[model samples]
Target: MGIVNVTPDSFSDGGRYTDVDAAVEHGMALRRAGADIVDIGGESTRPGAERVDAATETTRVVPVITALAAAGVPISIDTTRATVAAAALEAGATVINDVSGGLADPAMAGVARDAGCPWVLMHWRGHSRDMNKLAVYHDVVAEVRAELLERVDDAVGAGVDPRQIILDPGLGFAKNAEHNWQLTRRLDVFVDLGFPVLFAASRKTYLGRLLADAEGRPRPVDEREAATLATSVLAVAAGAWGVRVHDVRSTADALAVWRASGSPRLKTREN
Candidate 1:
């Protein structure tokens, strides 16, 4: 998966693609660079970010999704609102990458079920505004797994097909740096949950902090590609089904190398 933030305030590459033309071109470029899915998000879910109204969100992403879909590029709508998801689907997006894991909107599950497309349920505690305050976890790995499973159950109980569910640990949504690292280190646990896991540690603040300078300033977003690439390769090695990344070419190239190395099968639950 490749990320295309159509909002003006996403933590990384925000204003760069707000224009429909630029967003579509970028999605096509990512596809050419080997992105299996181009994820377009209209709202900025970055920590401390405020929510955008459904109308604004719809207006921002539908045009880009429609243009990209017209170009034959696979598209995923990265949104939590059911209305937005429905519009994006009608506009040609084939997947729903809900960071709220179906918790934000009561109608999201129904939209997903009716659409019958893949739904990415990311582990989340609350909305971005207060997520940082909710990042209290005793055992990050187990808690994230349990929470994600609950989301899976919610999705399933809402009449969604279990086979269409995908899980994401939500690296920075409500996690501290250490929590992020713990989740990444134990991603195999998520993979073993009998659902395809999506590892999306692309240029996250945790990676920036991990690679901070001696002065304690975090590494810039663009400079975290190397660290992001490492996470992608390691996630694949740990049996993650996919990775959401900013730089499609580098990650695609690295995974290609791993495949050339005879990517060994990792243990996973027999769902």
Candidate 2:
């Protein structure tokens, strides 16, 4: 999956693709770069980011999704609002990657159920504005797995098809750098849940912190692609179904090399 943030305040690549034409072209570029799915998000969920109105989000993403769909590209609506998901699906999105895991909007499950589309349920503690304060966790891995399972139960109970459900650990959403690394190291715990897991650690702050300079300053966003690629390769090697990345081509190339290396453990199941 490749990320297309059509907002002005996303942590990375925000204003870069806010224009409709630019967003659509970037989605096409991602497709050419070997992204299996293009995830279009209108709202900025970066920590401490303010919320955009539903209408605004819908307006920002629908046209881009429509244009991409018209071009026969696989599109995923990255939103927590059911209304936005509904509009994007009507515009040609076949997947809903909800960061709130159905907790943000009560109607999200119904939208996914009715559309029969894949829904990505990410582990989220709260909205981005105050998410950083909610990162406190005892056992990060076990807690995240249990919380994700609870989300799965809720989504299933709400009539979403279990087969269409995908789980995301939501690295850097409300997690500290240590928590993020722990989740990455124990990805199999999520994969073992019998649902396809999406590892979205692309250009996240935690990666930058991990690759901090000698002075302890975090690496810049553009400079973190190497760390992102490492995370993608390791995540896939550990059985992640897919990775949401900013540098799709580099990650794709790395995955191709891993596959060509003839590692049986890298074999993945179709979703």
Candidate 3:
């Protein structure tokens, strides 16, 4: 998946694609670069970010989704609200990537089931406003895995087919820098839930912290492309079914190199 943030405040490359035409053009570019899906977001869920009203979000995303659908590009609506998902699916989005994991809005799972489209459920605690305080975790891997498993059950209970569901570990969302690192370290844990895993660490602050110089100042999001690509390659090697990223061409190219080697199961460093 390639990311197209149609909001002014997404953590990375937010304002670059906010324009409708530009968003469509960027989606096409990503498709050409080998993105299996283009995820378009109208709301910025970055930590402490404000929420955009449903109408505003719908307005921002619909045009782009409609254009991309017409262009025959697979599109996923990255939203937590059921209303937005419904609107986007009707507008031609084929998938719903909900960071809230069916928590933010009660009506989302139903929407996904009704649409009969694939849904990507991300592990989430609270909304971005107070999520930092909620980042506390014990045995981060087991806890996240267990929580996501429960979410899978909930989604199934809500009539979402288990087969149509994909799980994401919710990187950078409700996770501290250290927690994010732990999740990265245990990226394969989510795959045990018997669902495909979507790894979305593109330009997150964790990468910035990892690549910081001795001065300890974090690198800017835009300056973390190398780290981002490296992390994506690592995640793919760790059994990720998909990766959500801002730089599609580079990631696509990197994955191509891995694919040419037969893209078999990833071996651990120890192996």
Q: All predictions: root-mean-square deviation over Cα? A: 2.3, 3.0, 1.7
The digit string of per-residue lDDT tens for model 1 on 66-166 reads: 99999899999999999999999999999999999999997999999999999999999999999999999988888888898899888899999999999
Please report, in order, the local distance difference test score of every candidate based on alpha carbons.
0.93, 0.93, 0.89
Badly placed stretches (over 4 Å) of model 2 are 266-271
Model 3: clashing residue pairs?
none
Clashes of each: 0, 0, 0
Score residue 138 of candidate 3 by CA lDDT.
76
**Clashing pairs for predicted structure model 1, backbone only:** none
TM-score of each: 0.97, 0.97, 0.96
The alpha-carbon deviation from the true structure for residue 260 of candidate 3, after best TM-score superposition, in angstroms, is 2.0
How do the residues 12-84 of candidate 3 rate in per-residue lDDT, one tens digit apiece?
Answer: 8768888898999999999999899999999999999988899999999999999999999999999999999
